[model samples]
Target chain A: MSNATKSVPDAEGRFGEFGRRFVPETLMEALDQLHEEYLRSKADPDFQSQLDHLLKTYVGRPSPLYFAERLTEHAGGAKIYFKREDLNHTGAHKINNTIGQALLTLRMGKKRVIAETGAGQHGVASATACARFGLDCVVYMGEEDIRRQKLNVFLMRNMGAEVRSVTSGSRTLRDAINEAMRDWMASVDTTHYILGSAVGPHPFPMIVRDFQSVIGSEARQQCLDETGQLPNEVIACVGGGSNAAGMFYPFVEDYDVSLTGVEAGGRGTQPGDHASPLTYGSKGVLHGSFSYVMQDEDGQTQDVHSISAGLDYPGVGPEHSYWKESGRVQYTVATDDEALEMFQLVAKLEGILPAVESSHAVAHAVKAAQKRSPDEIVVVCLSGRGDKDISEVARLTGIEM
Target chain B: MDSRISAVFASLKEQNQMAFMPFITAGDPDLAATQQVIRTLGASNVDMIEIGFPYSDPIADGPVIQASYTRALESKVSVSQIFKALGELDHEELPPLVAMVSFAIVFRTGVDQFLSSCVESGISGLIIPDLPGDEAAEVFEKVKGAGLDLIQLVAPTSPRERVRKILKSCSGFVYCIAVAGTTGERERVADSLLDQLKWLREETDLPLAVGFGISKPDHVEPLRGLADGVIIGSAIVRRFQELADKTLSSEDLQKELTKLAGDMVTATHTK
Candidate 1:
């Protein structure tokens, strides 16, 4: 069908040929069951109300839309605002999706939940939710990530989730995903795979985007109430594009508002240097969807490098690729240095430390605000708090704190 | 059918024997060694051989096969390289070669392009573990258009209606997953697999082969009357992993592979 309609992923989960259930024969029925349950759960008022209660009292909803007055003056053009997802429970936007999926797991009657994590934010969030719901939890993380994200590992383990280290190809996020899928396949009857991002097969991208849309809905109303109009630009950093999709999806029909996605430009434009697949990669299937992937000449997926473990992935969500082709959302890149600079600046100016993953969006917003008129407004999704990233930043910048 | 897969199954039927398919990851340890192993398996009593094209993310694979892919990929094995190496082999010395690849690899290389390369490389059939039902028809058509069989898998969890629909487009033999899990060695074949195979047998006259957790001689013994073929994958690949750790000579490695193939061949041949 046409990409113009906005209602995408028509029966077979094709976001204009970017998304599909490319999993094995065994999980097909599970995916079908999940899709059916998700639909029923969406329409069920009890599910909505319970999730709403958890979001309000447990995770804290309607996160404030704060005016970054100092950063706005620093940009010297447009007024800047931060959608404070960092203030939510678990110190990140990841909890938003995990809570919804945990509820789904219970609905499906699965007693165990498995997930893959790169930066540990999703793992911590999933573990936290599983702990609350009294379900068995397992988080597969790359050995390299476990070394780097020590705090998050401790957090996940403290919450009673088993942290399994993956020592496979690249020893990173993709490998963790592969391990988690394998685990899910072997334990499909008792387990639910809580995929962290807006990637993976059909229903997951839709599922995650719907769960995360709360960020956009809240920001939209909050922006209109605060500024008397919609912001001219909305920006969020994209790894698998969940946060960005959540923040941008509500504004798709608002043609006047520009939706921008910033990717990780790790070191340079050389192959394997960046995780910006949407900017420079070919279409291929990975995980369970056909999307833009960083692959080499022989179709082997290339290793992606980014200082931010969250964005160090070879592929983006299929919906992001579709939007890129549709020209609905403008995709850009922020180098590690740019993101790092923004990370430190936000802390010094606003007394708020942002995750390096979210700082990529802030870095782009800085540029976008500078290019816009003074009357225009920009809202940047502060996707997560940077407490977990402090050690990595210290190691990189040679500062203890 | 003129396909080598069908021909092999027909010959097996004539002899009152079951097909023995052994799986080896291409370029595991290295491409030369992988080719050597294939040549050895081909010369042995194997009716067919399945070559796994190593992928970064083999989601359907268990620990052993997944590790095999990692080792192969670490050695820089690519789809083009695998095909080129296979093309250099003397086809007469090899069993009918079937490729087991992930959809990402096929999609990246282009569907028609991948299938054509398989034809050029002497591949007779394909088993894409991740190309589930909804997208199988289009890919199966492309594989068939390239004059190759797109082998279908019937899992233990598949309902009768799903199995019936899957068998309709299936070519070669229907791959009956002996267990609900990914490919790995198991102590015993579950009794439920017989029921699944029995259900499939009622639906089609095509040959049925059991795989996924079929690893030992005992595993093959039980499937003698139930299945037309038995696939042994992770068990064989696990041997390769064990031998690689010892840094055995290439000839020795081939000998080990041949001996392993012989044992499974003997088991499948008996009764």
Candidate 2:
């Protein structure tokens, strides 16, 4: 990777016509302000030193790049490596972006931080940051998500964050985002929205992606240090594509390295049954930016289903859309049963409980690994731990938790 | 540059009266009830009417409008359905109709085709809150070429430079977001509204119309001299929300909505 990646986004925040500020006029100034501040923060020595300190001490950076020997032997064709982001504080890569945004909130002199969460990982991470900084935190989670991710909800509450239940639409991640956007519009003066994903309007996708790029940067160095070469392929689950974007950006220009993003396949290939927008959606807008979205011919968003709440969104990040369009990254899907199988297998075989979201990547990696030569290597980003999902997993497998 | 919208605002300017445009989701109750709502507001001395195309994710709208869109979409209302439902009613019976739709919908359907559809449906102006920056300059031309006006939203938070850019692209009028928030009812219009009105007035000849949180007759009075028009959304849509009770007939809905609109419409005549 080069020292700079040409800032993927142009002045209008568009990654080739994919991402732009498609929010209300009221939020335009804030978006512009955020973009400017983010750029400045990226270059400031003090900002970088402070953020780096937090990453190492608070969030516990340089998560292990472990060789999954049993899984590699099971595949029987290629060696597999897991970038253990699951070990991060709060048990997910969500903390990486939230901590960055929370710091920005203080820089902007905002006293409050608001966020929308799907499976509660982002909510917990945002709550943790606010607690650490003594800032007010409010998290919006879908009513249905709260029921599924009760433990994460508790964790967020424990950190002094107000959890607001969103009951509109499908009562999931998508609805929570809508509620959060409305909240930001009403409270833009004193509140900063710590959007959970690398999606949404303008600067958000770029900002989140920048914060998350640490994943790939660390992974790239670890693979080089351990194996003396870059991994053959880098893979990550695509919820709003933050982890994937973070893990993929550093390797985009490394032509020899392959990048794959795994999306949720839910129950079936049908639009409503699956959240695989890149696989079977038209170019439209959801949340804020223009991206691939599961929608009807009349342009209304379709309800999407996913076993992993994190990937249940109707749209992918604009950067993913651009990458797919440019043929830089190949995107695939993993069904509920496939992810669950990998989730259970990883727990027993490697003593690691990969989040169902991350298992999507593992599912694809296992398949691809079996087809490659044993000398070749594949690195999968285990984005988060599965503790928050244990109860839902039990219910799905016909066990009483 | 546009025909119907410009004419409506010009005639109001001559009379020194502010235009009253009441917004309602096109299929709030159903197409039949929506027709009655449009006809009722049209006959109640409104200068123009704004019809919202119900979207599944209306992020810029408040709960009242969001629920209204949900009701409309759940009833299986389609864009063509709304256009076909209102196809028989010509502009003369409806006044000039303006469309408030997401740019995502337009981009998905192809910008030229969406504009042509609006032209066919007799929609004279458009209010899209989420139109992208680059697409705006391009679509603004297509909208004018299709013989319709583009009404861009300008918030109080919009800086002077952004306001200038928005003013350059806009045609029919300015949709002033009275406060820095999504569309909803408010206890009072923000005091800073007068200054924004003055700032925009000094920038362009386009009419300045305030929306978002302006619900009652009192809401209109505050903007009497400063605003060229007043847009009532959530306050009006909340009444349509009552249609969910199923006991109210379309005529009764029209009567109730008309009485409410009549008072607010009268309030627009600030003289």
Candidate 3:
């Protein structure tokens, strides 16, 4: 990436028409303080060296970009490869961003870290980071999510983080975000909000994408080393579009590579159907920034449905909205039924049980593979392991054990 | 006017009709429609307009209001938009625009900036659902400095000490969150809570507005003799949604709101 393109989001932290500081007024001074602190710490060689050391040593780095040869043959089309983010410590790419932000939080002299979680992956990652850095961590989860993802609740608690169940709204991800924001507002003087996804108002998306860019950065080199060329297409499923944004960022300027984002197709495109914002939603603002959203005629947000708790959301990352508008990346959808099929297919063939959210990408890859040349290579971001989603998938699909 | 908010409340009280406080999420449905709803409510008999600054999680709200908030967030309503919408009401004879929002939004917007913006936008009062009285001192000072009223809430579960604290900081009117939980309509207001309201009436001279569980005309009428204002949230929001079909025009919505306001006013004034 050229300096011009790489610095697209400048010191002010803008990503084209996407990133900007759209935080609450109470958080302005603190956010400004954090921004200034982050800039200084990012520029400090010592800070970079320490962060790199942690990313390499504490949370395993250079996660393999393994070509699923057997699975590719079984699919009977383009060769498929997996950018194994599940191999990362804490079992997902969430750790990558959390470790970076947590280190930045400590460097900024913050005493505590607060995070909002949906499936609790980010909460666990943030808790893990806080444990390593010796910072007090608080995680806000929706009451409903806490009940559904009990294992994650236990995992976060075991990591020595205070887990507060938010009983607001549907007691889901959005509610958790609200509670986290409220907590941050009250404790901004000493707390850092380790946002889970590439959403929020401004600096968050830019900061998280930068931290998660390592996924694509590593994949590019690894893919080149093994295949002697970049994969023809890359696919990732988007919740807040974090993992997809991470894997797609380094390749944004790589014109030869095609990037596709698969959104949750929950039931169908009916009013109460899925969380496929890109395919079905229109441009609107959410979480302090303008993005695509599913709303009613009165402009009220509608309830979104998705088989995967992780992807069941009403909005996408602001950057994804920009990418969709600019035509830089294509956005598609995969129904819960289709994703389940891919989930089982991958488990049986590759012997890897992929997260239901990741299965959306796999489903998209399967569809694309059927149409593409047999020799073409496609890199699918295997975002996380399916262990956390086993019960949910089993319940939803009526498949036991 | 010593306090613009107090002046407005005093005017409503003099009319012998309990204040008709209509709560609408700014940008619900859409920003344009929200502006229209405000104008519609303003032109109607509404004594005060509580414009909800939509938050992602409204723990204090029921399904109808929660759904409205979801729409507002999806529509990308922001604190800035609330100020802008209020500014647009400059030419019209607007009912005082009092912000009904979560503490997070207030904090995110910045305490002083939010107050200053509210003042500049001609907002008469502030209602932060999550700002318990104990944590409201700093915000109260700011709101006072901006010459706007900080409306404090007294929930059913609030202890006497908390109520005293809330009464001390509150101006304009004391918002009684009729129930222990968040905002929504209920089938009935408990007799014990009514007795509590009677007790509260003896404690403070500030006009009291009973909210949360109020839905029907009977709900408004019963509280009329005891409270200074009857704050209706979820029911009105539900009515707005019911009238929000694409086929219905803004004029139609205004007519619907006018009828709803008329019924509420009738309930409060009759007997």
Candidate 4:
């Protein structure tokens, strides 16, 4: 925050030395065109009004910044607040981006959309926007994710989006992104690729972050209105880091707010045992963007693991890489056990079933909150709801749900 | 640019012929098979060979080549091993070599190591499809400084301004993506190929090599006068897949591959 880091990516989309387009020549012109269209759309008051209206009425925006009384008391130190993105329609912050991209898709006169998803929140959100706009949609999902995220898959299909199962390496989010990119390469003329997170080639990271920044912008104002000051700590889970980038962006100038991102540590610190790219990975390219990636010595992407499907990606957003390099944000990790425990604890104590991805932040917030005095305020972004994860969690816990 | 690459193109031009290059993923089926593939194509009158350094995510390639990369990775092939294996080859017997690699690998393996490896491996030129041509000046300059040609790709969808920028960064030859899509075997070349060729011929002095969907021997005849080289990717590699499947014997694979290469070579060489 407060000029601690480089400004936003340059005209060519380089975030310092990270986040340049590393895609095939076939997609470069289309990327330039998309970046131009997005800039115009961002400035158009009519487009802004339409998007704002949808967020406010259709998605129930200004999602509450509620003080989690029980979670705060249990931490026994700092007061904790929850940025309730879990309450947004489609039950995640993903819709904020999908709706925004969908508007751009229409503006560009594209009638078809392609997307890839991990935890299914992005898929469900993409499907919702497509169905609402009467646009053709296809969402690529990894076969492994399909088995675990059946509810979201069904939701997408029922909403008229075709969910293609990718059986490539790892059969997870990374493979899905690869497959979606291939589709984009072939269908770019009439299709707009709705990348689910603040990753991928140029303009996508900027676009997704701009749309999702509503989360932090609102949380900042609401926190001030209710508590009369900015929180000392802003914590969020990072998986492609869409929500975290959005939340961190608005507070980047608020020098007093300490930003922390919780990455999925899965089971352990070994290479394939976790998905914490920022903590354990080096700089490389994945899914069209230069970012921190879980790659071997020869730059082959490695298989990564996490209990939360959304947080199982092998690459982080380019902005996160820049932030890491600039010392603007402190990134930490939450192992599967810690996150699973918080999933249950938050459900019982706070009457909120946090998506396992957000449960990672909940797990870390416990430690961070305990470290601070009662006078300090710490806020966690509850990035999504856990409805899609109930069956997976039941199976993991050996319960028949 | 390497002196050998220029000599190869100049020789082809003197013969009133176009160069023929066949591509295969380096570690597919195994490095031994890849080495054999290079030798086979080399002996078949092919002008140059394009070896793919397998990447985990090869979005620029179609399903056939993508499968080859997957198979190569399953064997746990490393870039060092590939370089070592190729280094052991008799460059005297082979044609000029180029590698179609992802920029991610080049970035991971620093510029000095990568170019040194290329020199050690007898690779004459480089075709990195995923390196954004518009943002490639820095690496392009580094590669040019190392005396290795980093070929730039110009696609059918490229805006003219972007095309001009990309052309300035090219060396040795320009890889003209014959189609507006990824590398694959297609039924026909686009109807606008002649116009694109004419436009590119007027814009830069770099030799034009048409790739991406130039699959068969027949594809060569059509691009004869228009392009300086013709690259056959998935079609040639598809036979290697059959070799790996064991449905085709080594002897038969050689005969089939040799015949395919012979046909394209003949067509490319004939005015």
Give the top-scoring candidate (TM-score): 4
Model 1 C-alpha lDDT per residue in residues A46-135, reported as the tens digit of each score? 999999999999999989999999999999999999999999999999999999999999999999999999989999999999999999
Better of 1 and 3 by lDDT: 1
RMSD of 3: 11.7
Residue B95 of model 3: what lDDT? 72
Positional deviation of residue B259's Cα in model 4 after best superposition, in angstroms: 0.7
Measured by DockQ, the strongest candidate is: 4
Off by over 4 Å in 1: A1-3
Query: Between the candidate structures 2 and 4, which one is better when assessed by DockQ?
Result: 4
Candidate 3, which CAPRI tier? incorrect
Give the alpha carbon lDDT tens digit for every residue of A1-401 in model 2.
Answer: 32223358888778876987778888888888888888889999999989989999999997999999999988887789999999999999999998899899999999999999988889999999999999999999999888878888899899999999999877888889999999998888899999988999989998999899999999999999999999898899997899999999999888788889999999999978989999989898888898899999988889898999889888999999988888888999999999999999999889999999999999999998998999999999999999888888999899986
Residues B1-271, candidate 4, lDDT per residue (tens digit)?
2367778888889889899888888988888988887898888989989999999988898878988898998998999999998999999998888988998898899877899899988988888888867778888887787778988998888877888989878888999988877788888777788688888888987789999989887777667678899998999788878877998887898898899999999888887
Q: Which is superior by TM-score, 1 or 4?
A: 4
A1-401, model 4: which lDDT tens digit per residue?
Answer: 33554368889898888888999988998898999999999889999999999999989998999898998899999999999999999999999999999999999999999999987889999999999899999999989888977888889999999999999766888888888888888788999999989999988999999999999999999999998999999999998999999999998878889999999999999999999999999999988899999999988999899999889889999999888887889999999999999999999999999999999999988899999999899999999999887887888999986
Q: What C-alpha lDDT values do all the predictions have?
A: 0.89, 0.88, 0.79, 0.89
**Model 4 docking grade:** medium
lDDT of 3 by residue, A1-401 (tens): 12224455655445566545443334444555777777787788998888888889988888999888878887788889999998889888999999989888877788999999988899999999999888999999988888888999898899899999977566788778866776775567678999999987656877788889989999988999998999899999998999998999999888778889999998888866899878998655456555777765423457899988889888788788778767888999999999889888999989998889999999998877777888798999999988898887788778777
lDDT winner between candidates 1 and 2: 1
List ranges where model 3 is wrong by over 4 Å: A1-6, A10-14, A399-401, B1-50, B53-271
Ranking by TM-score: 4, 2, 1, 3
Put down candidate 2 lDDT per residue, B1-271, tens digits, no spaces.
4488888888888988999899999888788877877887888988888999998888999999999999888899988888787676767777888899997788878888888888887788898888733348988999889889999998888887888887778888999998787898889888898888987888999898999988888887778778999998998888776768666666677887889888977888757
Compared with the true structure, what per-residue lDDT tens digits does model 1 show for residues B139-258? 887778888999988887778877777776789889988888789988998999987777678898889999999887778777777799999899888877876687666667778778
Clashing pairs in 1: none
lDDT of 3 by residue, B240-262 (tens): 56655566566776787788887
